[model samples]
Target: MNIKITGSGSYIPNRIVANADFAQHVFLDEKGAPLTYSNEVVADKFRQITGIDERRYVESDLVTSDIAFFAAQRAIEDANIDPETLDYIIFAHNFGNVKAGAIQGDLVPSLAARVKHSLRIKNPKCVAYDILFGCPGWLEGVIQAQSYIKSGMAKRCLVIGAETLSRVVDPHDRDSMIYSDGAGASIIEGTDDEGGILAHETASYTYDEAYLLFFGNSYNKDHDEDIRYIKMYGRKIYEFALNRVPQAMKECLETSGIDIKDVTKILIHQANEKMDEAIVNRFYKLHDMVTPERVMPMSIHKLGNSSVATIPTLYDLMLKGQLDDQVLTKGDIVLFASVGAGMNINAIVYKI
Candidate 1:
């Protein structure tokens, strides 16, 4: 059986925080001189690298569930399906409502209640749950739902990814200036097409590299929440991507009976502009394939790195005409891939 994405939706909070706006949070030097770390530098970094100039932040009143529900509503509307008909809902998000007592798993029942109340339907078997996988999450969620549909466990699935990176960011840190909030949703239905997930490959280099990048978590005292704020060896991450991602893509396509030329576009994780260019160039040299347009520039710059929501958010944005249009078409092959903090790299081949 084949699984197709029949609908898509995305949500960004109304509040927009520009790079310059970040300067207000910076500290001054001992000499009474403002630190050199200006929002201009951070914003310019995102703009030059990702082509993003602005990103949205959730208001203090909003949380992950609010974002997920809104995006899910749009996805249902786009698919022209009633919420009561959705057999299952896969909510992919690592960051939960910080205001709540627990993480995403604990927040699911409440979210489901809201959905049930809003749609005025009763779904005892609705089965809403959370999956954690950093930035490669949406694809993982898709793959997981494929299993349920293939087993006849469900007729339709709504996969939603909602993130509030700002919840984990250390507002006092310059690096935290880049992350913004956003969410996205997609409807996956079973099909007979053999082309859905033509190939998928996941690589985990578990070692010190696993500790190379981290999101701050204060709720736990064991890891010292103070150390939980975003921490990364920038140079290490860059080198790892240059060496690892290209090889991962090559392996995925080769096993799928797909040649580089067969691919119309590659939708990679939106880490940044530099990594995007590096992966594309490396892939071109490794497979002699022409790279498609860069789709994450505006997102990375404006939306910052949204973690797990990055890919789906970009997917929703591109389809909404926020990015290049010629890149996606029916029967065209597209590659979705991501590499993130877990030291995990996953790539999935899809057809438009």
Candidate 2:
């Protein structure tokens, strides 16, 4: 059996957070003094470094599951499938729903369960669960759904990746600028057709690098002592992505017996604009093919890194012709890749 995405949808928060928004929230020193820097200077540096002008943030009352619900509705409508027919709801996220003004909290019933309820899905047999694979979580969920379809355990699956990174980010931390909130979803069903999810690869290198990106409270005496936030060694992650991601993508394409030149688009994790560009270029270089200027599409400038939500949301946008000069047609070969907090890397090949 083959697995194909029948429909897709995404929901980005209405709240637009420009780089200038960070100016007022800069971190303070140990003595309660503001860090010596102008917001304009920092904003310009962010643009030059990450190519991000602004990102979205959910309102105080919104949570991860809520955004996922919105995306799911759009996806199901696009697929034109009955909610009762869904056999599985696979949700992917690192931080679950956090209460307004709370730094640490999670959905007690699991995000998948919450989404199922929000959709008013009444089928008791539909298995709903969550997967935690860092940024690769959504792709991993799709992989699991494919396996279920192939084994005849399921006929249709809903895969969702959603996050509210702003809730868990340390406002004082520079990395805060790179995190955002959004959701994306895909409705995948079993098919007898030849083109779908062709081949894939996944990997983890968490032995010593598990802490490269981690969640912990700030130790600064002037900051909130009990609030949890994400922290990372930026240089280490940059080096890891530049070195590992391209090789993994190359191997995945090879496994599918697809030539680099045949690929139509490369939808990579919106981690860093420069890093994603370099990874795609490196993959094509391995095959002695010049990187096509339009081969890779990016939404990071507007969405930042919503962790698992990045790839699928970008994919949805491209499929809908919302991304400038990017579109997908029948029989087009597409590639998906992501890497993040789990010290994880993964890629998938699909035929549209």
Best by TM-score: 2
Total colliding residue pairs, candidate 1: 8
Q: At residue 336, give the lDDT of candidate 2.
A: 94
Candidate 2 clashes: the total is 0
TM-score of 1: 0.84
> Mind giving the per-residue lDDT tens digits that candidate 1 earns over 216-239?
453223334435556566679889
- lDDT for 127 (candidate 2): 88
**RMSD (Å) per prediction:** 4.3, 1.7
The sequence of per-residue lDDT tens digits that candidate 2 reaches over residues 1-352 is 6799999999989999988888777675434456688767777877888889899999988889999999999999999999999999999999888877875677689999999999999999988999988999999999999989989999999999999988887666676899899999999998787799999999999887788998866635556776667888888998988899999999999999998889999999998888788888888878888898788888999888899999999999988999888888889999999999879999999999
| TM-scores for candidates 1 onward, in order | 0.84, 0.96
Candidate 1 minimal-lDDT segment of 10 residues? 99-108
Question: Model 2 segments beyond 4 Å from truth?
Answer: 28-36
Candidates' C-alpha lDDT: 0.73, 0.89
Clashing pairs for model 1 are 2-191, 49-273, 50-297, 52-301, 54-302, 55-302, 216-228, 216-229
